[model samples]
Target: MASVAINMDENSIRGDHIASSMIDSELHECVRQGNIDDFKSRVQTHSAENLVTPCGNTLLHVAVSYGSDKIIAYLTEECPSLITTQNSQKDTVLHLAAREGKDSYAIKSLVESNPSVLRMTNEKGNTPLHDAVIKGKKKLSIFLASTDPEVAYYNNKYGRSPLYLAVEKGNKKGILDDLLKSGASIPIKIEDGDALPKGKSPVHAAIERRDKDILVKIEKEKPELLRLSEKELGNSLHYASSIGFLEGVQFLLQKFQEGAYERDSEGNYPIHLACKSHSVDVVKEYLDKFPYPKEFLNNKGQNILHVAAENGKHRVVRYILAHQKSTLVKPLLNATDKDGNTPLHLAACYGQPLASFLLLLDNRVDRLIVNNKNSTPYDLAAEISRRAEEEYAKTDEMTAVERKQIDSKNSIPADEIKGKEADTNKIGGDYFGVVISLAILYFHACPKKSLFERFPVIKRPRPLRGEEMKSLLGNLLVAAVLVAGVTFAGAIQLPQLRDQRHELNSTSRNSSHENLLYGYLFLDLGALSTSLVAALMLLWATFNYPKFQIPAVVLSTAMVCLAIVMMFGAFFCSVKIALLGSHGGFLAVTIIVVAVMFFLYLASLVFPWIIPLSVNQILLQVVLHYYYYIYFFLFDYSKWWLTHKLYDLKTKFSCY
Candidate 1:
């Protein structure tokens, strides 16, 4: 990077002489034009050979920048010294050619003429090899790296090696392979057999890029890099788990078994990170792989469940309790952290009602256990609610004071303030309602208290009429029979072509497409089996637990939607196999099935909202409302018309 060093006295004199020599515009003109005949004539006439440019670049720099191969060949053969001379930016001819990435031929001539130019660096301390990798010039990167192992060993000012740059690119075309085939040494392995550099980890760059191939290449070449942790980010597994890369996490755990339990400096295990990410699948995989330390704690003495609960991961909390054996998870429900806070305690402290409710529902939970601060889950929840109320009140007070000030200054309308207050409370009302629920639950210390036990049973609602019940049962039967018949047909009629007939059938020469047809057949049979189970559940719900009619209906509806998705997925796969013999076709079909299935599920959810509006007007006067409002019959309907007897209609609705 050092410029041509000269004494202070002759600096200006040399600058003037160089500037005068570089002013010969005609000599440099022929280089840009790439006129080999004109360049040869100019070289013979005058000493235009090595005059420096304004930026200390020779005529060779311009020719290389413009990528004129003919001019470059003539210059390299005549003025070979231009290959070694440094420009003002300290880039030699090779650096310029590699950085531009326009012509690999120009770069080759410079490297072949003066191989020592390989070591020359620019002002940024990046050699031509660094330039090649940074710009994703595969040919130049391979050439420099294969030329010398030391070339790949060089790092820039940012401590980024050439290999790091290539990995960061995440190129799909085997750029890492080319670098490895060259003499390029992997930058991760330090001397004394250490993998870390006592600085930032370059491996993290590849993880951030999500380039699994680069990671695999590094692991294959030098498996030690996979073992090393990012100084601040933990091991490779921790990094992968943090980002919810299930494939990356799975790969790391398979290759490096020790990394599963490897905690970062913060005492976070791989499960701790996966829990932090709120990825239930990864957490499940970790539990399945390494079931030990069922109640693993982090630096804060927080169990994985505690982490999930505190972070508002509702599904993760439920999964832990549901998926694992009850004996192992029973103790975790009340396990205390360093501050004597259990999972429920943290959930209460964080004002998570769903989490608090779920935990308290467990019969095994001893709600009487007090924390280090002598506060039970209920007490903590109440305290959190109070603090939140105080904060909310404080915010309101500030807003009110400002409003008073504005009113005094501008004298705005009084109605506006009232309307704005009403609008603003709608938001505060939502969170405030949560706080109230938590406070109310604190006294009972039981969330699974039945609806009749929690509140006085008003009158029981009237049952549906015979017509309505019959219609509901009829619709359920129709849907169940339709799904069952379709799936049964699919299972029996499934076929796989055995012979190869290019002209007669779609499955001609390609063996892969034939496998796809068989896969679709399996999918169709499985869907049919699930559809049969769903139909039986609907029948059980209809005949037996009529009291739990709504829940049974919702469950049956969900299963029916799932059956539709699976059946349609099989159909779409068959269509794609018949038309396009490609795996990408399956992906496109799967997307269509997902979108259609989501729309169907959405319609099921919206039906509740739409049906009530349409029924509200007509339903009140129909046969259903007559039974609902007729609480007491003072006089018989046949006798009332004959005798004109008066009766008192006391209640608007009556349930029997």
Candidate 2:
């Protein structure tokens, strides 16, 4: 009997809870359906505050969610206590009304009932004004801001205030204007929650977006914000200058002239950054406004010209040289940094060809100026190139080691390793092996003055300028690179090399076959080495060293010519090897064709030098000397042959 009595009491309490929940759902539904009479009737039976949804929202919150202005007004008037009630998201009725942005009547009812709710923030710390502005509801935002302007400066959990969001969203409506006029303080650090350590400001955003119109408003209303600077991005002008925002830079300069002199945390002035961006107009503007650009050096003691040259801004370099007067230009051209390096040194060390060319074009530029390291511009360029080559060699070796480690981890079979070794040995005997052998032999036997030095056609290197230098050097570099690639490909992938390797390794390895293989390897290695050296010399010429330029062109030209000759010899050798065991008639035919092609190629090279001989008188003497010099360098190697040829040529041309 006791247990039955207890169960009945538990059932009674459960019935009451269910009955109360049904009443609350009906009351909230009446609000959602905009039925004021039904909600009023339901509220008479239960306290409106006690009648709450599962999300802790009162009838007023429900009315706001459905955008029913009449029901909302009725709820605020009758159930005044429900005005400040919040939901699960901590959003008051006003917060919901502001987010809807479509119903101004509902918003005004909520604000007029309890104006303090206008500043009430949700879970994200955003006030009603923040939601209105973020929703782009211009009229609603203006109303909310006017009701309580202090909320405009209330930063949310993300540290973005209403005014910051308005400006950042590029809201051209009266919302931003009203916020500014209401005296909302511009935020100093608007955190974007990004990966960057730096935070940005509203003014920085405007400058970054290049919204000059928005900037103008901020300038007029919040003039103090123009002076604000971030830690990483610097001030408004610094940010604008870095990105080459021309209008922003100009506007900032016109509004805040002091910003041009301010440096970023990295110690770079606005003009220095402008030069880095290659903004010639901005650079000119800075120079025009500021009396002395030379004094505006960065932390590195580098001026605008130094920055421009180091960054390869050639047009800026050119513009500065051409537009500025000699009084200003001379100082800049000759100005040395803290390291004692002039602009020319920076240009050369950074390997900026066009910038180096423009700098060296100026007569006032002191080319002999040395840096703190006691190295001239030419010496620095050489050193930098040497370091680059060494670094490349190190990277190559590291890559090889990594590949070997990966292969070892994979546990390749023993037979595969033996096969790979065979391939390696074959490659060695075919290409690099021949290269090493010939390199050692030639170096050991070479005379102090190379045999080519005895020839008269190989003239001394002379300085070239302007288009002539650009054209000749560019062509030489291209040809050298192409020949190098072809020779490298030929060395590794020739089918005859594999067959030759097989024959050399087998018991039937003929001495004749060995000789032929060596001959092919010699020709291929010669072509590869000469082309590679030619490319190296051409790259050195890009440093714009005058002495190196002419010599680079001359030497690269000779090297390329020699590479072509060796390439042809290698091609013929490959064909001969391929036709080794074939009929004598086929071998004879291949030889004839290759020989004819070789002579034609030679004629093509020799004809150009001879064509200029019959042209003009002044050109005739130069052409004759150059032609014989080239001819002797290419063909006549015997010392006696060179001496007799030079004597005959000198005697014949004595009258001229």
Mark the regions of model 2 whose C-alpha exceeds 4 Å error after superposition: 1-25, 40-59, 70-92, 102-106, 112-125, 156-160, 185-199, 399-656
lDDT string for model 2 (430-527, tens) is 22212222222222222234333311242323345466688788898899989999989988865647666564444444555667678888988999
Quote each prediction's TM-score: 0.53, 0.56
For model 1, the local distance difference test gives 0.66
Q: How many residue pairs of model 1 clash at the backbone?
A: 0
RMSD of 2: 20.1
- Which ten contiguous residues of candidate 1 have the minimum total lDDT? 421-430
Off by over 4 Å in 1: 1-24, 34-57, 68-92, 102-106, 112-127, 150-161, 184-215, 388-656
* Model 2 lDDT, residue 178, Cα: 82
* lDDT for each candidate structure: 0.66, 0.71
Per-residue accuracy of model 1 over 44-145 as CA lDDT, tens digit each: 765645577788888788889888888887778888988888888999888888878754576686677788888777899788888978887777677777
Question: Which residue pairs in candidate 1 have backbone atoms (N, alpha carbon, C) closer than 3 angstroms, thus clashing?
Answer: none
